[model samples]
Target: MADYNRWMNERLYDAAATLPEAALFEDRGAFFGSLFATLGHIVAADLIWLNRFVQLPALAELRGPLSALPAPTGLRDRVADSLPMLRERRVQTDVVICDMVRRLEPVHFDEVVRYGNTAGASQAKRFGPLLQHFFNHQTHHRGQASTLLFQAGVDVGVTDLNALIPHEA
Candidate 1:
């Protein structure tokens, strides 16, 4: 799972890195404005989920959708601006999840986690399924962002989960 996460992150970064400032801002009809806003949404969602997993104060207000579109930044700018925060938060989230999994002698797969639904309705749901959805949600949106970037003439690198290796060679 760690390898999968790391790989997905790298592929996401690689795809993001290839996007030119011009293409990044070009409206591809993606939510937010262009590829840039979509990417921003992905980053924002990841941050929110990680914050909850790590028990950190919510960094930004929990909103259903992005409001002010984030401007396109260069590859370097994105690396400098978002990667560090995302990576750090990801590590913290992974650690907490691993610890929780370790502590659970046997978890009930059917057990649900209660939370406020998007419609502001109260709900209870299974845990493992929700976790799966959380990760899958990232992949789904990132895939859209990647496609938008490609349409805009950028090349996001290999996206397979099996392709990501640890940072250490």
Candidate 2:
């Protein structure tokens, strides 16, 4: 899933780069209002979740790097106002996610993750499900961003998950 996240972001950004600078940030009446804001939201939310994940002992190695990414106070908070900065953060965060999944143990999956939501509500859930939610959240918003791109006359080709699946030898 980490690979999928990175792959999709790369494709999306590449496609987005083709758009005129004004259209890239123009309000399209979407959930986040524009492609830039949507992308920024993804990075911000990702850093938020990574902040929580790094609190776990198993993911301690992630602490140092993730600390460099700003912790978004709210989901809509802009993590990067420029496309280049946003893309850089996305690449960095994806690397941390790949590192995190590589280090997961069976025990870590079932362990409860306790963290506050952006709403400041208390929460406790198993790490496995929380991790699932984290990835799902990305896909959901990415889909929206893709649609926004499409509406603006850009087509992101081959978004199916199967595109990333490896064939057995």
* Lowest lDDT block of 10, candidate 2: 78-87
Task: Provide C-alpha RMSD values for all models, in order.
Answer: 8.5, 1.0
Expressed as tens digits, the lDDT of each residue in 1-169 for candidate 1 is: 5446545656665665565656666777766666655655555554444333322122123221222222222211231134445445445444444444444323544565665544566767665676677678778877887787677666776777755554675
Instruction: Report residue 34 deviation for candidate 2 (angstroms).
Output: 0.4
- TM-score for predicted model 2 compared with the true structure: 0.97
Global local distance difference test of model 2: 0.91
Q: Model 2: per-residue lDDT, tens digit, 16-99?
A: 889988998999999899999999999999999988888889998889988888888799998887788888988998999999
Error of 2 at 140 (Å): 0.5
Off by over 4 Å in 2: none
TM-scores of the candidates in the order shown? 0.60, 0.97
